[model samples]
Target: MARDINTKKLKKNAFRYSKVRGETASRIRIPGGVINAKSMAKIAEVAETYGNGTIFVTNRQGVELPGIALEDMPAVNKAIQSIIDDSGVNQEERDKGYPASGTRNVVACPGSRLCPFGCYDTTEFARKMDKMIFPNNLHVKIAFTGCSNDCGKVRMDDFGIIGMTEPQYDPNRCVGCEQCIKYCNIRSVGALSLVNGKVVRDTDLCIGCGVCVAYCPTRAWTRSKEHYFRLVLLGRTGKKNPRLAEDFIKWADEQSIMDIVKNAYAYVEEYIDPNAYEGKEHIGYIVDRTGFDEFFKWIMKDVKLNDKAEVAHRIYWGGKHYDRSNNLK
Candidate 1:
């Protein structure tokens, strides 16, 4: 799990004019991966005025401006700092890492904040994640998405938050159309004709993909207000290496979400070897080598578990299945 100096090289080469090989390379963190036209313009100005006229975007949604001279690093930092200050973020707050630190590392899609199909406000929750649990000892990337659509590509991160909603059955509105059953790819739904010439739905099989709800003409499959989010950890996606994160927790609220993140960081800090590999930075590699169950127990030493149902759930991805029962129980 050597750190991909080559990946960094590719990134650097992509913005060749940025001169990343020098001693004073600059890295800029963008909170929630959010950027405004004005902020971008300021970045361009900084590139032109302070350093080379180029920028590189990181997978974590950070921007790096290379080729900055050692002497000019202070100026570049100041210029970027000023723009961040005028961007409605307080200077003092920035110093205190309000929009930096863990917040800066967060990448979130425009969930319910603006997207019509979004089931939740992923941006808002991402901001909360930055503030509450980001400053810990964890060194892996975390990503969030507003819905199962995963526009933010949460599956690629060490920790991922996916928005989800459970469908509610309206017995009165159900026309037994079986449209939902037809559209469901997961076969989580089933329909049967009733004596009254209407269809009845079996809710147990519904996987909550929303396919039925979208196609249903009768609007029988409506989303409930009881919507929460999904949490996954130790997942990675790429061509050379592909893996799916196991579900650490599901349908979690803000408080539970914080607890999960804290637990994850605690685990990483306790057992992971920092010098294991130069570029072996993510959590999945650690799990691959040390075993996830042992990792989980090391972190949950003081915590008590009441339920282990989710532990037995198998995670299927990358054409392989991983049973987490040993880790959970």
Candidate 2:
């Protein structure tokens, strides 16, 4: 008789159960969606050898080899071993499948390496975040967008990390061209305006998108060394309320970003429902059960933010409970 599939182990390797009994689909991790040609060949080989000779690219930018029989899992897993190493799927520990399954694939937009508008190295930073938080059972989605274009759809993810740049202006070099103002009005947070024939940036309205900084001529605008990040949180799709992720962190440094994300895992562990199905609960749902005030308390617990970093001044969700009371949940 074929051995029973170890649901726990398979999930750790990014496998999902199929409709057909005694079969599964293995999700191959490609952090930041960056994959080498050689690795792609190996994945195809695994599919042909142990699966249905096919692989599906997940919306999260990973690969899923379908039609794996429970009996063939061992062979499939062995094939995946080298890939896990080369891809750094779960390098948090050695000789282990994965610690948890909550943190999903780290999706990213094309970075400065490929796009001129890109601000940071999306794939590199995404890899760093992948190793930092993975294999956890809590349901979470983390994504990285290179710039304000948000080609990666950061706003729709559980944790959206958007690259930011603080533009420093040299008034002496100002040509009174009103170019920044024109650029800022569209495709931006509407923070720039002409003041006395020079561009004045409204700090409150600015989202740190670097639009003016990019379009500014004569080198009047320069990027800050701080390398800030804007973090949006909690947006999800589920049986109940589906809403866009809300912005929480603005102008955060790498350290602050890492710390807040690390702390968020702790928050999930603390408030996570015990009776959740499949040994998991969406963090968004947990936030619903508990109040946002309570949820953020845990998120912000014991974390020191940078002076530049701004926490959500007042987080307000207009949507009501499923009951339709229309109050913040």
Candidate 3:
């Protein structure tokens, strides 16, 4: 007869079953990844009663409680549900679950809602994005930041959103000060002290980082009258390769934002194989394998390009290159 297999012993060792070893785990989702005082207190109470009296804060703004008995899972879930419901907050959403190994994670920074340098309200935009544009089965992490300061770490996500401000020049007000030229690190601005007592700039060099606009004391250099946010796609920072996101769309408003996100998701759904799990679960990987131009064409098929003036303002950073000829215009 074959040797008796120690099935019971094997099962006990193979799976960390809470019933056999007496442990449990629970995960909670915080919408927009924000948790308030009442939610914290309720979570603490649940942990005290059914768990190990401790909680773990996840990178994606989730809360986890571990080391509880198997019997406590239902009670813990119920308690958390009640707490969330009583607080008049609905935390139950299908796409909010944590990914097993891929990159369908969403991260956001405190945009204009809280930060001073924020060009637009990142939080509000993120919430909108979470609602309509998230991928159904695509495994890609997305991140959003209100400004280029990148407090939200958008550079690390597969898809990212960053804020930008464009500079405008009032030729009449420019006093031929070379301050903007001196401050620009990108050399986007060139200053010439003409015999006519005026300074000029070469607009071609402007990359629009906004260094000179912010430093201008006279406020002669101004950002575009209509300030909007820009979205960057296909960025990744990891061991295999590290890279910064490139600007794909400029001067995107709420409607345009929705269009862009939806189109991106649609493209991913069509082109990417649902079963393939090669390496990174980010759009950047797809872009690398294929090409960004192809992806852009797919998503931006019907989208109309913003005017050159609008586009110019969206990419402008402050510098002293006002055209005196158009002072009145």
Best by TM-score: 2
Tens digits of lDDT, candidate 3, 183-216: 6643434432333644454554444445666767
* Root-mean-square deviation of candidate 3: 11.9
What is the alpha-carbon lDDT of model 1 when measured against the actual structure?
A: 0.60
Model 1 reaches what TM-score against the true structure? 0.71
Cα deviation at 148, candidate 2, in Å, is 2.6
Candidate ranking under lDDT, highest first, comes to 2, 1, 3
TM-score of 3: 0.66
Q: List clash counts for every candidate, in order.
A: 4, 5, 7
lDDT (Cα, tens digit) per residue for candidate 1, span 1-329: 33224333332222222334443445555546677778788888887786668877777777776666545544665677655654333333343222223223678888777875566777667766766554343456778887777778887777788776667667788877766666564443343235464545454443344556667788777776765667777677543355766676665555556666667676666667768553344666566677767766654455443331133233433523344233545
Specify the highest-lDDT model's number.
Answer: 2
State the lDDT of candidate 2 residue by residue for 1-329, as single tens digits. 74666777777656686888878887787888887788888899999988899889888998888898877766776777777888777655554434555678889998766976677889988999988887666778899988777899987788888888888999988898878888888778789877887888898888777778788888787777777788888777665676778888888777777777888888888888878787677677787788888877777777788887788855654433454555665
* Model 1 worst lDDT run, 10 consecutive residues: 9-18
Worst 10 residues of 2 by lDDT: 317-326
